[model samples]
Target: MPHLTIVANITAKADKVELVKNELLKLVQPSLKDAGCINYVLHQDNVNPTLFMFYENWQTRELWQEHMNTSHVKALNEATEGAIEHVSLQEMTGIE
Candidate 1:
């Protein structure tokens, strides 16, 4: 299967920016250790600390789906429910 690329955006409530950021950062290490993960990187907006993004590469789309079902991911969802204002995720495949 072709590799998958994921681009995810996260917006946190102003007051909970640091908390949300810390939570998201915690996922990186474990995500990288997952079987099909090629890379899992997190970034923050320069002017807007509450805005974050993730760039991920997985060996297959199924692997990425498995990542979503992991305990850490579920924990993040539950923990940041209100603190996160918006989340946008995009999955892509290279054309060539």
Candidate 2:
């Protein structure tokens, strides 16, 4: 089966960009350690500091779903409540 790819975009409230970014950064290390995680990279938009994106690859869709339910993810949700403007997530399979 092809690996699962996730593209997640996060936009922070104008006043809460740093807070949201910090919270998002906390997810990287832990997410990289998760089972079946191939790569978990975070990127910030050069033109728009308020925009952040995560490019992730996992061994399978199920493992990626498991990662989403982790404590750290829950903590991120709690910590950034009302601080985020919008979030968009997409799951894809590489076309190899």
Reference-based TM-score of each model: 0.95, 0.98
Poorly placed runs, candidate 2 (over 4 Å): none
Candidate 1 runs further than 4 Å off: none
Residue 16, model 1, lDDT: 98
The true-versus-predicted C-alpha distance at residue 91 of model 2, in Å, is 0.4
Clashing residue pairs found in predicted model 2: none
Backbone clashes in candidate 1 total 0
Quick one: RMSD of model 2?
A: 0.5
- Colliding pairs, model 1: none
lDDT of 2 by residue, 7-88 (tens): 9999999999999999999999999999999999999999999999999999999999999999999999999999999999
Best by TM-score: 2
Cα lDDT tens digits for candidate 1, 5-70: 999999999999998999999999999998799999999999999899999999999989999999
